[model samples]
Target: MSRQHTSGDLRADRRYAYAEACLAEGDAAGAAEMAEQALDLAPRFAPAWLLLGRAREALHAAGGRETDLQGALRAYANALDLDPEDVLGSRLRLAQLGVGDALAAISPAYVRALFDGYAARFERHLVGELGYRGPTMLCASIDALAGAGRRFARVLDLGCGTGLMGATLEGRFDRLAGVDLSPAMLAKAEARGLYHRLVAGELTGFLAGEAAASADLVVAADVFIYLGDLRPALAAIARVLGPDGLAAFTVQSHDGAGIVIGPDGRYAHADAEVLAAADAAGLSLRSLTPAAIRRQNGLGVPGRIAVLSPGLA
Candidate 1:
């Protein structure tokens, strides 16, 4: 996912750069023109196609022109054809336009590339600018349900971005292991010296590789937003967790009957669907409490913190 991108022609690259700047400045028409010029020079350049799609999408959003929307979809589909792994997030863009599957919109390549680019200032921006407290709220829920003094022999942190959740439980666990998709974020977490083991992998795959009943606690703070379905992850968690062990996680919640992709591209799972997934996974819920996971635009984002144990439903 950490690969170089270029048009192979300086003029095309320049046009692409200018197109990016134009899009950032809200000049959709200029951006579209520049992106078209770039594509004309380098028809095989996927980034140019992606930029063209974004420019057209902005134009459609402003004017509600069906032609612009159709053009955007065609450009996105072309981008995806050029880069099947979707490192440029063409699938997400298509999903935003309601032209693709929402459940599979997010690609690991895209997430890895995104966090790799944002890793340097991720903590500062997320904690300082976004006012994110997902780790803190998740830890609080764990303590409330499992007891503050409960110490675990082994703990697993899923989507452990920069070791935030691991840092919160530093002294409570004898051994701490973390799994994340972004290598850059894993490097940051490694530098913190909190996790005894750090693996760069997807959450469910990591959990599947672990021994059954190996962990006493598993935590996923602000990670479920990327996953539209929870049944697979919950089933894997139940397999790895000991009978007495517990799993604590948080989800962006909505009032709908099922999961929905929010305008921000994050998945928001309804409370009933979450409970149903846990039940199907043979995990009994200890707590499902409303929480404010973070602040978006200076207002609290609605979420839910769930604590569960491997038990009869």
Candidate 2:
């Protein structure tokens, strides 16, 4: 951190600069080699960690070492931890890993904050680049429920990034509230002129704090993936629903009967698991439909939308 000038500093500088240039030109291994040489001369050169991160990423991207991806992330994380604001290093690692921009980033603290950052351009990147289907399909499923005359005077939109779901359901509800964890995404949703109120909080806890048995209809579009086990969330939803209250939700599904979290931290739940959770919560699954998130290369990933109502009702 001192930025001191030394006798061998000139040699170290040249090699470090060469490593970066090689990385920029797509020679990741060459860049890594140059960086090692520079580090040999100047053991404390912080910039070289960044160079090494990019090199390892390129190696990972080329499928040069799938087995080493975890190790690569650790190396990149070490560099970032040392220099929290290492822009180049952070950019390469997070971008290649594809963790920050998606729903996985949504949370209770203004859960929309991360989504809001991507809100202005969320749809474009989702549909065009990353093949996002959770949000759109969630909207569609909620609309179907409304069409079945499951209208409400008070509605809650959980994880309402940019108010997309609120916009789709506004016609069916006299009052609409959108709650999310990110302030940034809420800003965009607020600007959309859809929801009557916007709040920042975690999905289940926020839902729990509201006036008891208040919401007649609830829609959680693509929110369940963030939850590994659905029982806790399902229990909360049941609390907010009155005797006749109805809820519609979306969940990624696998072919079998279990739940698993992918490397992305998004949980994919099976039909039986989803059903069991609903049952345990004293809610009856009125409908379960197979759906596709979006299509890629003629194959669509499996997902489901479930409509639930309290069993005692």
Candidate 3:
């Protein structure tokens, strides 16, 4: 799950590769068979188990068979047991299927593993393919609120994947610091030379470790989608932000009252919940604008970009 050799058995590895190919080719039955063969040889291989689960999930989606769904659940459960850290995102799959805790927060390991693997082609794919405009949108929002020629003494970029957000805020901040869980992503960000400080750590933990009232602006562009509950992050942001500091972020939004885990393994938060979290965290919600965060399957994904400041009331 950590991008290491997943299977020690050569035959099992081959079978797993074939299973992946089969799934890619839309041969769910063949994929399942191949994954089963791999698991028979290496029962403890988490990747194979995950593949089996995916194959079964595909089958269940097509056939609507309870048996297939149950099989998928078992396979994912086994994978989760083998790797509790959920680097492969077994928990997300379970939640997506509505079989487990629907509001479960994505595992940090999963996010780290995901971005680490994507770090190489991340900007190209996300911005070019998916049409991601989170960084640009956030920067515009900040500039609009701060007015012309406004500059920040200190800025924090939460989940600063490949320094995209830092790059967007280039001339606006005197000092730019970024934090990400993936070392690979941090390496990519470091290569950009946009950030003054680059930290490899979880966003919440990094925020908590910073001195209180230290940051003039804290930004988390498209970062909250991986986190179902925003209260903790909001509180940490509030603690680290100066009295007049602003916290800007974005999230995949839903019409529901709270949160929902989508099939794509991302969390979508409702406007009500966002406001509630801001209130509870002692932050004032300055704005929540509906925007298209990215494109998925040729359509824009519904999301909200929000800005918050220390509460005056």
Candidate 4:
């Protein structure tokens, strides 16, 4: 049974219904064509345009024509241009295509959109399909971080996807909060009942909203991979921590960007760059260990987990 949405828009909606039907049947070319036709009638329908682009892209991936990439990029860009309210995630798909300078032009917005879109099935695809052990492995590692002041009064799990980290910290803390950009992900987290509250927001902005000197333990597992540069998020994390606070997070160790890193569009960071970012944030690294990278596309890559504290701590 194919899932369906109940939006009554008549022509455009019916076109979308047909396109979706074709898509569910695995006819990417037919779906793309129908979606393009719908978009022609409703040029402002950003989702339709974006879906057309995706269908075309999927077709391209399955031995479709080389020209499909360019067409998909154009359709996605057009959708984004029409409605910049984050209604469509063509930006990230554009970034993944690597046809042009789409990455730099849309990496941040694309990542945000990508995460939001995947928020619903984020864990299922990542953990069940890709064998993502980031949270499972990270939770195990956090046990070792319990040193002299391991007891946390207030804990914050940044990018607490589906509350996996919070589950690990469950009973270990009195007050807990989670923040991420996707409500669907938060919905899953909320279902876990581990976090006291889950907020829909990005890292930098959410960190800004948090009161200073509140969180004693802040952990972000597999969150930093989407980020190309780490200085901004690091600074944000430093700002929200107590003087003796601790933060544990993960990072990918590859050379470039635009997917193909860990098979989940993960962007690996360099040691020098991470060190420099930490230094710039005035946070000293207590320990950085090269942990087992999560499996992606049925393979594993190198990764690291680090515990950091305020310079004064």
Candidate 5:
């Protein structure tokens, strides 16, 4: 069931709407004032709190006011207290501001909402503007390691946004199945008729539901960034893979010891952490090659393409 807002009062809702409009119009002070008024009327209105937080953040950015930053933090904290499921993504905001420890994992609701809104322009912006070539890069890595004339019986595409990877591996696999969080993205993938099945759910959850040793190949192109800890997902992949099955994925890399949430709200994993996670999951690392996953802000984002197979006793 969807979460219900605390603001049952119609007047409070109207004030919140006006605050949102003011924020959109670049009037941060006005938005903050209106949001405060809305909150006064309906103290538990989480949306109003979120708006107030955003307005304070804007004010802080504009003038570097410590009080504004503190206000933003308090407002975000209040929203999280009212809605711990993080429907407003207060945790993400807090992490981005360096005010708290990064979340163990990004909220699935946030990822779904983000992709649902970005589905229409995802391909264009990612491929054209950001120079995203994750799918192509993963396929190239596969060809280099697996050699020519290689094929798989069944393939699972995790986080298969718009079937870009499916399109790349169209004839290479006998059966193709896709899993993603966003129905809108899945709809676009379905329109291409590239996958035999498409499931709208979290990656690990979908993998757990599949029959054991069912997939010969599992691929997650540019998807691991949303996942902070790789152990659970890798364990699920290990469980679902055939004896000779291979799991391939890309992850943004960091020089530190563990995963860290970047300012962009994406997680970057250290090489050590990834290797340790794979080893713990009883998977043998076949390859871990550095590559430029995509371009962000006109610069190449450093990442790794990893291939793992079932470990031998």
Candidate 6:
């Protein structure tokens, strides 16, 4: 169902639809006026609030009006308050505006909703348009550390969206399991039949339910960008890995001391933050090398592929 339909008012829905059409036609002023009317009729409509916020943001971009930006912020805050799960991703917008602290992690509801909507076009857009090579590059990083043709008895693919990583490591593991937040993504992965099992849940929560030392290898390709603080997930990965197990993942890289939420709504981590988190989680960093995970805005995004093993106490 469309978000506008949830308002339960035919008139409000018509206004909202008109607002969306105006926005799509680059008529921000018209959209804003119509959205305001929609809000007047359905004051608590979260999607209308989001549309108003976006229209105000567009106007601010064109006119450079501080008041418009502030208005956008208030609209977004109202939407977030009405939908704390943040299915509309207002928190990311707030972070991009530099008005809110980078969230420790993106809300699962947001991720799930985003991927569910993008599932059908994800691979084409990511691989063909964005030139995403995260899975292949991460696998190469693992092979460089573990030696080519190294095999594992059990492997876990964290945030295993569409099983891209699983496809890369198909014959390299005796057993493979996957976990992801989006049911739509998991359904695609299941269709690939590369994983022995595919589960749908948040990464850390899924890891918490697994047996200690159960996985011989864990891989997260282009997954950590949604996470600001890496400690919790790192610790959970450590707990789930066997003594000889290794964990490998890719993260957007930055030069700052900690994590930063980029304007693109992804988290970029400094090397210091990643090292500290791995050390705290009792994981030995075997490799941390510069790489390009994907392309954004016609440029390669700088990133790091880190491979880690269980550290002795």
Error of model 1, residue 273, in angstroms: 1.5
**TM-scores of all predicted structures:** 0.97, 0.69, 0.97, 0.78, 0.89, 0.95
CA-only RMSD, every prediction: 1.4, 7.1, 1.4, 4.1, 3.0, 1.7
TM-score of 6: 0.95
Question: Which residue pairs does candidate 1 place in steric collision?
Answer: none
List model 6 lDDT by residue over 158-200, tens digit each: 9999999999998899999999999999999999988999999
The order of the candidates by TM-score, greatest first, is 1, 3, 6, 5, 4, 2
What's each prediction's clash count? 0, 11, 0, 0, 0, 0
Each model's C-alpha lDDT?
Answer: 0.91, 0.71, 0.90, 0.74, 0.89, 0.91
Candidate 2: where are CA atoms >4 Å away? 1-70, 76-113, 127-150, 263-265, 296-298
For model 2, residues 233-252, the per-residue Cα lDDT tens digits are: 88988888878788888887
Question: Per-residue lDDT for 1-313 in model 4, tens only?
Answer: 1222233356777787788889889999889988877766777777787778878888888886878877887888887787565445455566677644432333545555566567777777877776777766665566676643256899989888788888766677889999887676788899987788888878788889999988888889888877766888899899999987788899887554332333355667666667778899989877677876567546676888877888833
* Model 5 misplaced regions, further than 4 Å: 1-27, 62-64, 99-101
Per-residue lDDT of model 3, residues 110-183, tens digit only: 89989999999999999999999998898777777877557999999999989988887879889999999999
Give me the runs in candidate 4 sitting further than 4 Å from their true place. Answer: 1-12, 17-28, 58-67, 99-126, 145-149, 255-263
The alpha-carbon deviation from the true structure for residue 78 of candidate 4, after best TM-score superposition, in angstroms, is 0.8
Query: How well does candidate 2 match the true structure in TM-score terms?
Result: 0.69
Ten contiguous residues with the weakest lDDT in model 5: 1-10
Q: After superposition, how far is residue 240 of candidate 3 from its true place, in Å?
A: 0.8
- Cα shift from native, residue 133, model 4 (Å): 2.8
